[model samples]
Each structure stands twice: as structure tokens, then as C-alpha cells.
Target: MTEPRTETVTLNGRPFFLRHWGNERLPKLLLLHGFPEFGGAWADLAPLLAHRFHCIAPDQRGYGQSWAPEAVSDYATPKLVSDMAALIGDAPFAVLGHDWGAAVAYGLAISRPDLVSRLIIMNGVHPVPFQRALAAGGAQAEASQYIHYLRAEGSEQKLARDGFAKLLAMFSANMDTGWLSGATRDAYVAAWSGPGRLRGMVNWYRASPLVVPKAGGSIKMPDLPLEKLQVRCPHLLIWGADDRALLPEATAGLEEFAADLTRVEIPGTDHWLHHQKPQEVARAILDWFPDR
Candidate 1:
């Protein structure tokens, strides 16, 4: 098994920490992690794919040792996408993202199609369909209600109280978390314990423009320009069928945006499917791009 090599690279005058697996000479694959988790979140999956590609996982803006700005506006989609664009320089690479990281990955693919050769999303949603699902006040909206709580004032304190009991509960809610124990659990806690890291992580929810309506109460859907949001690259979506937070509705009509989209659902797994079944996820990815 290949261990990750850690380093810091400056993007837009800000330090973004990165973890590298496999040889630098290999084909590049950028890995983006979601909220409350750092680049290390890819530890299990990256090594498996490292033999074929150079796996690069970044802490992103608001997590781990990356440059986490204080303002909510700093975490906006454009900035997040720009951070990634800067990191990759001029090379076109494969991009894989999970959860909030998927949002950034989609943004990158949409905004800079030339830079992304392939796109992969693990249990994540695109903004247009996700927003529609959120506004419909259905299962997805109800499941996403936690977004409001995380966006609320002093949410960081609430999540941090009692040694992050609330945060841990939220992470393990309706999902198998047997993998998140001992040293793995300690690593996550230590990352969250970083100064302003909790607030930074929560700020992703606060900064997002997607609106989640109350259950059984519908809201007007915002205008999303489909032409502008289309993903031109070959896209693959790996779903954990049991994900409660992001229901099937969240990914509805995703094919309209991704001209070439492939979806594979791994059974008996939930939102943290990557953590729970890295081998299966890696196999799915490897099978999808056998020539890579």
C-alpha cells in the first residue's frame, strides 16, 4: 500500500495543503473532499488507484491546513473552483469529488471544461437538480434541513460542544460508522479541533446559495442556466443507495446536464460509502475507465 506524501502549495496567494499518492509521472487525478473532512479523507481510496494515476487530494479552502478565510463569501463556488484551477495549472486531469467536494468538482467541470478530462462524483449532487429537489419540499428537502442548522449563527460552538457529540452523531446518522473509530476518529477530531476549522467547515453550508424549504412547504425554484451548467466531460456518478441525506431525487435529471453520464450504485452503503467501501468504490472507478 502506498502512503501519501504531504505538502503545501500556494493557490491565489493562499496555502492549500495537499496529499500525493503514486508517482508524479503518472496520469493526474485530483481528489476533492467534502465538509468536515480534510484531504486525508481520501486516504483509503487513493492508494488503491495510485498505481494507475497520480492521486492528489487537497484539504480544500476551509478544512485541514488549507487557507481558510473568515468570511462566508470566501467560500463561494467560483473561489473554490478557482483554487482548484490554480492547483492543477495547465494540465487536464481526472477529477473526483464527494459531498461538498462534488459541488466544486461540478463547478470546475462546468467552468473549465478544458482542464477536466473526466469527472466522478460519489454520493453528491449537481446544483440545478439539487436546488430543485431542495425547493420541492420533499424527501431531499427534509433530509437537507440540517443545512439550516449548520448555517445558523454559532453553529460551530453547538457542533463542538460535548467533544463534538452532535457533529459525530450527525456524521453517523443512519449510516454505518464502524470504520470511524480509534485513530481514524481521533484524526478527524484533531482536524476539527484546529483553530477556526469547525467554523470554516460549517461556513460551506452558510455560503451555499441552495435553499432548502421546510417539509411539505414548497418554495419557488431559482433560475439556473442549463447552458452554463452543462458538464462536457465524461462523467461518472457512484451512489451509495442507502444515503439518507441525499435521496434519489437530488440526482434526478442529472443526465440533462452531463451529456455522457454513467451511474453505478453500490448496495448496503450510505453517504459515507467511500469510507465504508473504498475497494468497491475504487473498483467501480477503475472499471469505468479501464484504459486510464
Candidate 2:
């Protein structure tokens, strides 16, 4: 396997970091990381896919060596989309996103379908289903209690001290010893420890651009309706059946959006499918790529 090469690129006029694996002759795969993480989230999976495709993972703004701005709006959807568009340029590549990156991927496919020929979302739901689930006010609320903690002041500092380690420990408790390696843990800590990283990450929850209704109000989807938007390209959704955060119900009606959707469920896996089942995840994506 070839070692991934890191490169510096400018997105939305701010410096960002990207790591690429495999030869330029292969199909391009753009990987997007989730909250509390950088592009390195795909480190374990990239090498596995490199044999067949060129994979590039970017450290989203405010996450690793990427530019960190003080204002919350800097993390807004428009700016984030613009940054992704700039990075995508003329390359019509496939995208895979997890968590916040998944949300961004959804927006990107909807806003600039020209750039994304395919999409793969792991452990993320459309904002519409998420909001409706939140309003349902029973199990959804219980599952989402962590969001409140994230939005609380001083949460970042607290996480920096204890929560960070706690999250890392959970991976060990839930997965095989071979799954959670020292290098992976170190990379996660390094990215999470970056200056203002946690704050910028939590800003997604605090400064939600989506119109969140009152407690009992009806839930409306985001600007793009997952149902109406015909994903005119190939789409794959890999979901962990045992995900504690986002329930299986969120994907209940996903077929409405995907004209050509292939769904795969890992019976025993959790939300961190890449970390828990790296090889499996990587292999699945490689098989899904066009002409792979």
C-alpha cells in the first residue's frame, strides 16, 4: 500500500489540509470527516482503497491544520459549501461523509450536483429527518441529550480535559483491541487538540442555520427535500444497525431521494463504522465506485 501524501490547498481563501492516496489515473474519491475530527478520519480506509482509486481527504475548516476563524459564521453552510466547491473545482468525483461532513455532503450534492457524480453517507441523516425526530420528543430526545451538553458553555474545556479521553476509551471498550490502534488514537487527539477546534466543531450545533421549530411544532426538512431531490447519480448509504446516536428510523424513507440507492447494514457495528470496521468500510466503498 502506498503512504498517503499530505498537501496544502486554499479553500474559500483560507488554507486547508488534504491528504491523497493512490495514483492520479484512478477515479477520484473525496472523503469528508465528521465533528471532533479532521480529514485523517479516513487514514485507515484510504490505503485500502488506494489500489483502485485516488482518495483525497480534507481537514475541514477549523479542524486540524486548517484555518481557524473566531467568528461562528465562518462555519456556516454557504461558506462551507463554497470552500468545498473551490476544492472540488472541475473534478467530478464521488463523495463520502460521516457526521458533520455527511451533512456537508448532503448540501453539496443538492447545491452542486454537477461536481458530485456520486455520494456515500455513513452514520448521518438528512437534517429534515433529524429535526422531525428531535420534535418527536421521546426516544429521539433521549438519544439527542448529548447535543445539549455540546451546546453548553465550557463544554469544550471539559471535553479537552476528560471527554476527549472518555470518547477514545469508548472505542476500546466497544471494539476489538486490533481495531483501535495507538496511531489512530494519537491522530484523533492531535486533531481534537488543535487551537479552537472544539469550539468551531460545536458551533455547528450552536449556530444551526436550519430553522428549528418550537418544541411541539411540525418538523420541516432543510432547504433541500431528501424526498423531492432526485439524486440523479449513484448513491450508497452504509449504516451501522446498532448506532446509538442516529436511529434506524432516520433511514426509513431514504429511497425517496435516491433513484439508485444501495443500502448496506452492518449488524453489530456502531456509528464509528470506519474506526470499528475499517477494512470492511473501505472495501465496500471501493466496490461501489464506478468502474472500480
Candidate 3:
């Protein structure tokens, strides 16, 4: 098999970086990376699925070498969804996301179901269940306190004051071996400290106006209907049973959106399930693509 190649393309007029592996003629799978990371997060798993599919992992805006827009609204859900759609063009693809990427993928699936054929979320809650937990208070609020810190002013200064040591620490503390190497970690740190990236990354939390209120209430789109919002194409939920930020309660009602959902729980793994268990994550994705 050939080594994966890194490439760049413009999405909605913004330059984005991506890495692709596997056969061009095969079906395409788009991997969305989480906070403070890059397209390299899927480096290890992409090749495993390469023989049968074209795996494309992108460094969502604000991280890696991708374009990081200064405006907070640029990181909004609608814009992020547009960016993904623009990146993939008219191609039909399956969407796989982890952490923050999972949130973006959910919005993408909701706003433009036509672009995404299937959805796979790891270590994140479904929007409906997430909304429910937030209304219930306590755990949801506690789990989300970090957002306050992120959105607060002087965040950039604070992050920079420590010379981004905390950011680097979080990356190393959270992810597992396959997700990043020492060299990759250095690259991530550099990107975060780069000209406009840190501000762009935190702006995602700042611009997510739907989050706080939505967490405080249930899904508001009665027209679409949560139950009927199911992705008929197919869906998979791979979770790290030991996830810290998202607990089982948040996943309590995922069945509502996944008509044919396949739930796989990775024992002893944390919120960064993709990194903690890349082989298993890859296997779950492979199992979902029609034939084993």
C-alpha cells in the first residue's frame, strides 16, 4: 500500500489541509478531527481502511495548517457545515468525527443530509440527549464549565502566558499513542501558537450560540422531529465507556436519531477513543461500509 499523501484545497475560499490514503475508486470516508489537533489525528487508522476506501481526514478550521478565520461567526455551525460540504464538493461520503469534530458532524448531518450518506460519532453525545442533560442541570453544567473559560476574554493571553504549555499538556494527557507522535505534537503546538490559530480555535466555543441555550432546552426543531431526523442511510456510535467529559446519560437516547445504529463501547477507553483505540475504531468503520 502507498503511504498517505497530504494535500491542500480551498473550501469556501479558505485553504484547508487534508491527508488521503487508499484507492481512489473506492467509496470515500471523511474524518473530522477534534479540538487543537489536525488531519494527522487519523494518520494511523486511514491506511487500515485504505485498501477498500478512500479515507480523507481534514484539519477543520482553526487547527493545523488550515485557514483560521478571525471572525467568531466564521466558526459557527452553519459555516463549519458549509466548509465541509465545500471541501467534499458533490461527492457522497460517510462522516466520522471525534470530540468537537463530532459536534460539527452532527450539525452537518442535520443541515445537509444530502451531502452525508452515513454518520459515525465517537465519544460524543447525540444532540437530543445532550440537550436533555443540559436541562437537567448539574452534570451537564459541570461537564461544560470549560466552555466558559474558552469563551471568556483574555483567553488568548492566558493560553499564551503559559507559552501554551497547558495546551500541549492537554493534548498529551488526552490522546493515546496512535493519534499523535512526538513530532506531530510539536507540529500541533506550533499551529496553536501560530499567528491566528489559537483565537480561531477558541472562537468556535464563542460562536456556538446554540450550545448554551440548547443545552438548557431540548431540540427546538419540531418540524424536523428528532425521531424522524434519523439518518436512514446508516449510523454507528463508537464510544469510549470511560469517557470523562461525556457520560452514559448523555448517550441515553441516541436511538432516536439512529434508525440502524450500531453501538460499540470500548471498555477502559477515555473520551479520546479514536486515539486510545484506533484499530477498534477503524474496524467499526470498516464493518459499517456494507461488506466486512
Q: What's each prediction's TM-score?
A: 0.98, 0.88, 0.88
Model 2 has an lDDT value of 0.76
1-292 per-residue lDDT for model 1 (tens digits): 4679999989999998999999999999999999778998998899999888999999999898888788999988899999999998998999999999999999999999989999999999999999998888878888888888999999999999999999999998898889999888998999898888898898888888888787667799998888899999999999999998889999999999998999999988899998889999999999999573
- Relative to the true structure, candidate 1 reaches a TM of 0.98
Clashing pairs in 1: none
Residues 188-211, candidate 2, lDDT per residue (tens digit)?
788888789878777776666544
* Root-mean-square deviation of candidate 1: 0.9
Worst 10 residues of 3 by lDDT: 214-223
Better of 1 and 2 by lDDT: 1
Give the C-alpha lDDT of model 1: 0.91
lDDT of 3 by residue, 1-292 (tens): 2467888898888899888988778888889888766787776678788887888888899887888888887887778878898977786788888878888787777777888888888876667777666556666656665667778876866776666866655554543535455776666667677678888888877987534432443334322357544566577888887665677788787777767788888776787666667688788777777774
Model 3 misplaced stretches (Cα beyond 4 Å): 1-3, 169-181, 210-229
Instruction: Order the numbered candidates by lDDT, best leading.
Output: 1, 2, 3
lDDT of candidate 2 at residue 105, scale 0 to 100:
86
